[model samples]
Target: MEQKSVWLDEIKFKAKPSLKEDINCDILIIGGGIAGISTALELKDEDGVVLIDKGKIGYGVTSHTTGKLTYLQGSIYDDIEKAHNFKTASRYLESQLYAIKMALDNIKKYGIKCDLEKNNSYLFAAYDVDKLDKMKKFLKKTKIKYEECDLPVNIPNINAIKVNDTFVFHPLKYITSLREIIIKSKVQIYENTRATSISFEKDYYKVTTLEGNIKAKKIIICTHYPFFVIPGLMPLRLSLEKSYALLSPYKNEKFNAINVDDEVYSVRFYKDNIIVGGFSHPLYKNINYKKEEDKLIYFYKKYFNKDIEMAWQTHDLTSHDYLPMIGRLNKNHPNLLIATAFNKWGMTNGILAGKILADLALNKQNKYADLFRLDRPISFTKVTNFITNNFMVGKTYIGTKLIKNKDFYKNVHIEMIDGKCSGIYNDENGEKHIVSNTCPHLKCSLIFNKLDKTWDCPCHGSRFDIDGNLLEGPSVFDIKLK
Candidate 1:
């Protein structure tokens, strides 16, 4: 019998109360997902490390992912070349390949019993069968070892683009092990704690949270999205794309990894069942969170009802150029770094980022640093693609704000202009004040989700507190009282 996720409720974490008193650490790692835990594990041999998660680790996008480990990231190389150059694309693929090997090595090193499987990864094709031709051209130009081969998938009427040496494993299990290692390293791990706000104070950085504050020499944002909004502008710099995954019982299907061209669908056999993942889009266009779940259930009923065991969901943040962003935040904030925007290639890239970041934190030079540079130049196509995709979010946000509600009591404030949501609070002087009503993210239209008591972004699914503080992101920044 396949064991359930380590995060199941029966599990108990007898952790001490987080750092209530102000303390300093050499590094303050935020967001205990794969990137954060992996980073902490890499830096475990180093001294003075602190890692904190708003909730338990591995519960973020990593938990919900299909966990495909391969260098073939959907239609990304085509865009990578346009955004930067062919050399960048070559470096990216090479780095991704390296990351995959690193992941396997780490699993072996820890003896993590996550159902790791080696599968042949395929970038399946649909209307854009020509995409294979494109890949061939890129292969020749970059002098990389790959082929334009038709995949042997059971699914009919679709051509496959095969990328060799891909693997899949249970992400949560891998991350949990990393977390354990980080914790055992004597590195401080805090759960259910948040870094509410951050400010640079001279040589140190002050990280304020609802519970307490921490003074650290360096901060690493593995939060997936940078919570500090305007300065980092992660939401604006990046795009949020979501995909679905279904894990059903396996009943003798022979093949490896499979992803259709145009990324309509992807499938891989995992443990007892085949993990079906893919069918992606910009976050705002298909805002129905349950669509993926529904698809999984529907697939179970129509196709493989017998072997099916469980269903899981995951989200990935894709950059415009379809690559992971790693390295330092900027020259000014040298101590601060980010490893995010994996573009669905987080399995390897996320792990690799941790190693590179650990080296960076310890003042050791990493060879891959230049390729994953934080501030790469964006081409015209990238800018256009970003603007085009975000326009829907902008429009949605603006349209929602124009709605006039008489029942919107004192607690309700709306932005007359972009229609983003704002919080209504009474001041000591009893004055009515209004704030910007939209999410600072891709400017998704905000709806007051009554149950959550927060302004939820309909576009990319970010949630903000009634006071406009960040409850969730793709937005990264909170709704501000402008």
Candidate 2:
């Protein structure tokens, strides 16, 4: 099966050219996904604003999302309440609700043809009755109206909480509409422009790309995984989780629901397809992709008699504390901002971050900004979690070095090239291609992702093509070819 997002195929937009020369702008936004575009749209009135993407706009995480936008995230409020406080949870919910409103307002005002649908969102629990009760109590405390109901699906769930005014939409189509407005508003957009390094030159920041440099008064790093390491140190604060998703013939479901049980299962409908997403794990280990797909199919067959049409996978950055870090990259540098660790709910958090980042860049005050502040004091729990998580990554990095070639796949193995480690993939046609096995970001050893046929860094979620071309970041440089 081809690895592609159904949403990407469902919409089309004119492509923007890569940056060909050095340019200066008032603000520079990197990463052309939902967050970057939303920031550009919020700054539409500002002149000399530029946005650049390593690939095409809306083709990154935005296209690959399950596309459910709602404040009823799976026990997230409860989780926040446990970790922080009720006020923090309320602020998070308010930010998300405002994001939903902004999305709806833009869709109606701009008349975006993104198959937007207003529906209720549900969070159900099968065996976790206490969890459901706790969520209900939290909602009651917040004065948010929620109903307890039996789930419509065949699966046996003890209870489900339903919240109204939730939504699902074609993310790419929505992005198309946003891009149209951004273009008209004069935000210079450039695709295929990979940002390599950033530096401070006098009062302005210079962001160097593969083709040219962009000098701007301020910069927003919305690259999903923030690239800069020194100030932000994103890898230490976040862990990457990969999840699989598939599309099937539309099941007439009136609501989008997710179960935050031991195993997660999120379901929503867009157009004639029901998007089933979940089965998450850290992607460092060898995964049986076929087995995961089988699980999704089995679940579908048991409830709905529909054949799966498309399948894909996506990665999300989860903060140790459960709240997204959305503020200055470093406390010392007020002009540099970042937004990461959405924890698979980027549809709302991503856009919400854009608004916060825009406010920071424009010197406007926002009430919810402190909830996701970048320089917040790290709790003991966060510190311990960070240490434990990095230990796993380090283990994987060392273990990959010790694994012998004889134990590798029939068509793939690792070997030394000019005294340097390299991965060798023997294609079905019997042609062997060799590329450096070391990730350029943080020097973590790369693992071959058989499902996607790309080399992935277990430490920070950087991805490179089989030919060593950079596919995604936190890593900006491509792996060296032998």
Candidate 3:
């Protein structure tokens, strides 16, 4: 079984060159995931637009997603209504529906073959009938058509609601095809170019990358987690969640389902394989990575009774208000925009973010702009969650610093080497690999991910390979010991 995302298997693309010298552009985008690529596609006709990524396009969080394009997200409208109001929730629902249509229109216009399959989406409840009922009421209030039905999969559920106008597709295939189209336009794309910092100049912002500087009149941060904090205070408003997924060979199913229970189990299909994902927890709360992954595997085996072919995990940033932040960073810098905290529904939110962000950058008035602005009014729930989430982050940071020399796995151990805190892993050939145990972003101690054999930061979601190369980040610098 492979330890990587199934979407990344056998797909190939020629990576664009990294930025080598200082360059200037009218607009500079600092990520290459779904959000970044989508935004680039929107601005392809505009002159002097450049996009750069620390790694290749479509290989980051986008590759690890479940790739469901459905507005029937698991109780999102209910959550939004509870957090804000019905009007807000309804507007958010409208945005999602519009985003789905945008995706379909783009696919049709470009003739992109991404295995787009129209299927029914189900929201089921095994024990949480009250939550399912609440979702049903919300759907009815929003004038959405849904049916009472049983889940097609052989999972224990008491009630289920179904919507038929949803879809599942290959996220990487869609993104790579968009990348090909963007490359043929005027937008410049560079891979392996990490933006380390951004500084405000007299008339523009200067982004400092590893190899060069990017000066642009407008900047959009599409990075999953923004490296900076002061402009938006993103860390306080956002929390990270990690979920596990596994694939097993099965006949293609025409439906996808997610339960509204405390432990979310999302099931979908790709060709002849069944993909099951769930077992989510706050990034700071989950340190036993292997045990968490095992729970999902055990759950799949109990129901599907099939051998797992591949497994992977992903982290998502969730906002306190349960809405994506998709406008200017702050009033002081309208030119500095950002789109993040999708709350695990990146396939829809990311696509809509492109239109909202592009409209903001171009000084055009997008109808949904006010709905997802970064400085929107905060609710009592958002304030409470902000304090709780940050408190957890602080506790985790201090807790990791206090512990040392702990062994998470037999092959991996943390120890002090030459007076420096280092993590050591012994390979199958008995070769020892060592690197700094501290995360470069905030100096938080790293936890060894046993299943993936990588070091992950529990405070934030920064990750590194066994050799200490940066994989995902709010941290751009690698953890390799100098």
- What's the CA RMSD for each of the models? 6.4, 1.8, 1.1
List clash counts for every candidate, in order: 13, 0, 0
When summed lDDT is taken over every stretch of 10 residues in candidate 3, the lowest stretch is 227-236
The runs of at least 3 residues in candidate 2 whose Cα sits more than 4 Å from the true structure, single-residue gaps closed, are 285-291, 404-407, 480-482
What is the TM-score of each predicted model, taking all chains together? Answer: 0.82, 0.95, 0.98
Report the lDDT of model 3 for residue 25: 96
Question: Where does the lowest 10-residue lDDT sum fall in candidate 2?
Answer: 283-292
Clashing pairs in 2: none
User: How accurate locally is residue 434 in candidate 3, as Cα lDDT from 0 to 100?
Assistant: 95
Candidate 2 lDDT over residue span 1-482, tens digit each: 45678987777765788999999998999998988988888888888889999988888878889899988888788777777778888888888889999888888898899888898888899788787788888888878898877776666587888888799988988888888888888788898999999999889999999999899999998899988786336667788888889887775766799975767888888776688888778756544455665687787778777777788887889888789989987667899998889978888888888899999999999877888998887777778888888788778778766754533566777887788888888888888878888889888877777777888787778888888999889899998674
Question: Which candidate has the top score in TM-score?
Answer: 3
What is the Cα root-mean-square deviation between model 3 and the actual structure? 1.1
How far in Å is the alpha carbon of 371 misplaced in model 1? 1.2
* Candidate ordering by lDDT (highest first): 3, 2, 1
Better of 1 and 2 by lDDT: 2
* Predicted candidate 1 versus true structure: per-residue lDDT over 279-320, tens digit per residue: 677766554455555665565456555554455444567777
| Higher-ranked by TM-score: 1 or 3 | 3
